[model samples]
Target: MISIWIYATLFLGFMVLAARSDARDLRISNRLTLTMAASGLAAVGLLGGGAAALLVAAATGAATLAIAWVLFEFGWLGGGDVKLAGAAAIWLGPEATLAFVLATTVFGAVLAVLLLVLSRWDMMLEMVGSHWRTRLTADTISVPYALAMAPAGVLAILARFPDLF
Candidate 1:
């Protein structure tokens, strides 16, 4: 039980940090993603979920990375986003990983649309700080995808560990 709380706390804390960093800089640090993945494996072991569970989680994470790599290759997702998604999948395990991917896709689409609408409003962009103004008004329109990923990740976590609530 204690291990579950620790696992949840670690996952949530790292996710929040990743979201903030991605939003601010449009980048998720490799260090943060690596730590998140490593900690998730550690948490699984601590939970006595057994070697099978750990292997499943690892395989899920690997599959996610491979898919995300293809997305990156197609120029659909940034490298940081790929790494972050893969790391998140490890925490989500096999079943919840599917939910995370689906939810993240939906959230990403919504976020992109919202950003496009908001960007059209010059006043709205100006009201925010210069840094945000630049981010929102950029011609390229890079979505801070981790913002979308974070909420979906939280939902996945809750779904995977409903007893925690």
Candidate 2:
């Protein structure tokens, strides 16, 4: 039981860090994603998921990578976003993978609308002159999709362990 709490905390912690980094830098570092994947696998295994956890994580990651590749080709996602989502899929596994994807899609749509509105506001756009902000405000580039992916991943995790709360 205590291990469950630790796993949840670790998952949320890494997700938060990834979200923040993606928002600020317009990039999700591979180091963070890899660490999150490793810790998540450990957590799930420690919580009695065993080899099933490994298989699920691997399958989910591979599937997400394939989908991400298509999204990347269409200029709908960044490479960092692809890596982040694939790593996050490992944590979410097969059972919650659909929920995670749905949440991410919903959140991404909302974020896109929000960025669209904010981009039009000179005041909002001027608040942060960072490269990320520029990319967000630009009409051509994609948003930092990890912003949506991470939080949705957290929600999926929470849903997976409803009794934990």
- RMSD to true structure for each model, in Å: 1.3, 2.0
Q: Taking the tens digit of each residue's C-alpha lDDT, what string does model 2 give over 1-165?
A: 237677778777887898899888788898998887777677666777578767878788889878988999998988888877787777777767788889999999999898887777778878866775777566675677878987797788877777877
Best-matching candidate per lDDT: 1
Query: Candidates' lDDT values, in order?
Result: 0.87, 0.79
Model 1 C-alpha lDDT versus the unseen true structure:
0.87
**lDDT for residue 112 in candidate 2, whole number 0-100:** 89
In model 1, the clashing pairs are: none
Global local distance difference test of model 2: 0.79
- Per-residue alpha-carbon lDDT of candidate 1 for residues 4-47, written as tens digits (9 for 90 to 100): 77787888888899999998899999999999899888777777
Superposition error at 148 for model 2 (Å): 1.0
Those runs of model 2 whose alpha carbons end farther than 4 Å from true positions after fitting are 130-133, 136-139
TM-score for all predictions?
Answer: 0.94, 0.88
* Model 2, backbone clash pairs (residues 3+ apart or across chains), number: 0
